[model samples]
Target: MTTSSSPLTHFDGQGQAHMVDVAAKAATHRIAVAQGRIVMMPVTLALILAGNAKKGDVLGVARIAAIMAAKKTSDLIPLCHPLALTRVAIEFVASPEDSAGVASLIDGETGHVSCTATVETVGPTGVEMEALTAVNIALLTIYDMCKAVDRGMTITEVKLLEKHGGKSGSFVNP
Candidate 1:
């Protein structure tokens, strides 16, 4: 469980779960970036690299899934507000070079592909949930598409790398 200095935003002062009213808040440009990795056997990696997965293009399908998931974040997560996204991007790389939206990719013996989701919106609410949802869905889709080839695949390090806009302003994971 996590605790906050202030009341949890999803709950009212009375401790009841509720959708936050952003009617009084000013609309601002909001953006969020998230990343996660799916680890699998080297053989499975080779299959994906060779486009031999039985379920068609794994990364291609996952990229679309991530974008769609970001747009439908409100429907999937209770208390989240739906926003008209300005931009959404999903990228995957075995070894990433640090850039504005992507985090420093993990370098390890485990064969993993890093999936990064970047979401932007002009609204009263932030798009952190949308970015995170996109990453989660992307990772899950990768697992689903590759399950037959490697049931041992694991989704790990799902995280909200950064967020910008709203009253809280910008935040980046250190």
Candidate 2:
């Protein structure tokens, strides 16, 4: 059954559940950051900005949640190798688009709430998935916690912003 990289070691071509062997792979530092956005009404956005979203500390809780989720990526996503994350950071920022002296979003809406998650590790594999997962989980948490205030919230543009320190090298979004 030995073929190419070998049948026992190479599982991608076999279509079976098998953990990748990293014994021969060199260990290197890895880091990745992902970002996303949640759009909602201006009033709803104001409630969050004022720290009165009824859910209490929306960004604070979401940040913590993202960090915790990143640390437990393996448990949440099947097939993901359990990793000891060296560091995980999640951030939230309000992005309001204004055109000169004109109001943005027609009715002066809050535009969007940006959520970013950065993950780092010192291991053989990469942390891109973990970082992206953290951003997703955090955005979902924000939606869940603020649904009562704004049911129309939409999450968009969830992507890896950048990654560095790996055998395959670094990646930056254009």
TM agreement with the true structure for every prediction: 0.88, 0.85
* Candidate 2 lDDT over residue span 1-174, tens digit each: 333454554365545557777767777989999999998887777676667878798888888889888988889877678888999988887766444412244575456789988899998888888998889888888898899978899999999999998676989999
Show model 2 residue runs off by greater than 4 Å.
1-11, 97-110
Whole-model Cα lDDT per candidate?
Answer: 0.86, 0.81
Error of 2 at 28 (Å): 1.0
- Whole-model alpha-carbon lDDT for candidate 1: 0.86
Q: State the TM-score for model 1.
A: 0.88
Residue 85, model 2: Cα distance from true site in angstroms? 1.0
